[model samples]
Target: MTKSQIGLRERKKAATREALSWAALRLAVERGLENVRVEDIAAAAGVSPRTYNNYFSSKAEAIVSRHCDRIRLVGEALRERPPAEPLWEALTRATLAPFDGAAEQPDPRWTAAVRLLLREPALQAELARAGADAEAGLAAAVAARTGADPGGLHPRLVAAGVLAALRAASDVWLRADPPVPLQPLLAEALRQLAAGLPEPSSS
Candidate 1:
């Protein structure tokens, strides 16, 4: 009933959500998506199947929730960047923060699993919805920092474009024949956007 109690309750809910999501992703990676079920995920997370259903409708949603949480956190990070920092610079740093330490090339098995997950229709839908939510959150942060209207074209367009660049960069990284450090690829993606996406010259 008190403020501290309310905060603690919300924190507990968030922790439970994260645990279920983490379990789903781990199961998918270890046993493949088709082999995993909501029951399996709930057991892994030490929650009942009914509790899992309260948080996520399907296995795909549970798996994608972890990535979406990171996306949502990027918006929070952007809001905390120095107010005087250039918009693109702050945006780039916030976006890359979640992925910075994961610079090592991915294992081929993980890449294969990710590729499979990306191709799933349920996950694709979840990802699309997550992108929209992330764009809205980032646009609000941009509006606050730059004194622009969150619903206006400038904030909306910038947020949408930034997320698009993120998706493109992720796609490129997944398809890289010899896997490369994702942070550099993601940085290059944002850098290209900050530069107005200049065309490359032929060698």
Candidate 2:
């Protein structure tokens, strides 16, 4: 096949994967994560169980798999930031782009589904694994931005710090009664990170 044809084929495959994942997440949110099976997700996506397994090993994976794409978007955004921009500013802006764009927002039911994942010990582990993958992607991006070795501790540490702040911000927003804007919470998180979290006074 020609290169353009190959690109189109890959795009189609990606679209399928996204469809399956979105369906899985939606179902999990509507019901409960544990209550939703792989077969259920496959049916929801109009695919067979074999196809679902080809894309994801388990239901938990299918639910949170799109996190890698989010990381890549943030990484690309950071890469495109002006050279004079501060690291925190670039990182925060990059992190916020995906949430602000034309992409479909998660249903309100999905928000509750995420809370269920957080509460479920097994699903929580899967979520953590997905998070680790995102962090690795972010680390590579940070290494490229600062010219650090990809495997170096600095890149990993910086990536962890940034993601931790992002997670904390999300948690705070999620727990709020009316749900506050994520950007301001994220900004404060970055600010706290940049300022090195306040230290207790010495005795």
Candidate 3:
């Protein structure tokens, strides 16, 4: 196949994947996760059930795939940071940059849907699968930046810790009563992580 053809094919696949994920999230949020099925999501996305199955194992996986995509984008951003930048500085900037994009503006409905997904056991399992993949990608990026072996302990530990901080921030943001902006919360989380989680002392 020609280069243009390959590019077109990849773009088409990405569009399909995005459509399926959006449909899954909307349906699951509108009708409850237990009420959503593969066929329903495929129909909503204008794809067949077989095509949906090709992209995701279940409706829960489809719904959570969007978060997984964000995680992948963070890893890519981290990889592109200046090589001479301090590890934590690069990580903080890279991790929050994606959320800062104009296309990533806050959506209360989407945030609520994510909160609902977090409360679902089946969806949480799918999220764990996605998290594992993100962690592996992050470890590689850490290794590239710090010259540590990707398979060794240092890179893996740093990647895991950074992800944990981000996760904690996300949970706090989602649960906030008045709805806090995610980017600033995530920034503070990374900052605290970089600062070694120091305690406040009376001065």
In order, what is each prediction's RMSD in angstroms? 2.2, 3.8, 2.4
Candidate 2, RMSD to the unseen true structure: 3.8
For candidate 3, write residues 12-63 as lDDT tens digits: 9999999999899888878888888888999999999999989987777888
Model 3 error, position 200 (Å): 3.8
Q: How far does residue 24 in candidate 3 sit from its true spot (Å)?
A: 0.6
Candidate 2 — which residues are off by over 4 angstroms?
101-110, 151-153, 198-203
Which structure among the candidates has the greatest lDDT? 1
Cα error of candidate 1 at position 105, Å: 2.1
lDDT by residue (1-203, candidate 2, tens digit) is 99999999999889889999889878877777768888889998889999888888887777766755665577778888887887778888888776674223334454555776667676678768767887888888888888899999998988898889878977776665555676778778878887888874598
Better structure of 1 and 2 per lDDT: 1
What would the TM-score be for candidate 3 when compared with the true structure? Answer: 0.88
What is the TM-score of each predicted model, taking all chains together? 0.88, 0.81, 0.88
* Model 1 CA deviation exceeding 4 Å by range: 1-12, 101-103
lDDT of 1 by residue, 1-203 (tens): 99999999999999999899989988888887899988999999999999999998888888889778878888999998998899999999999997765647888777777887778788899999999999999999989999988789999988988888888888888878798878888899899988999999788
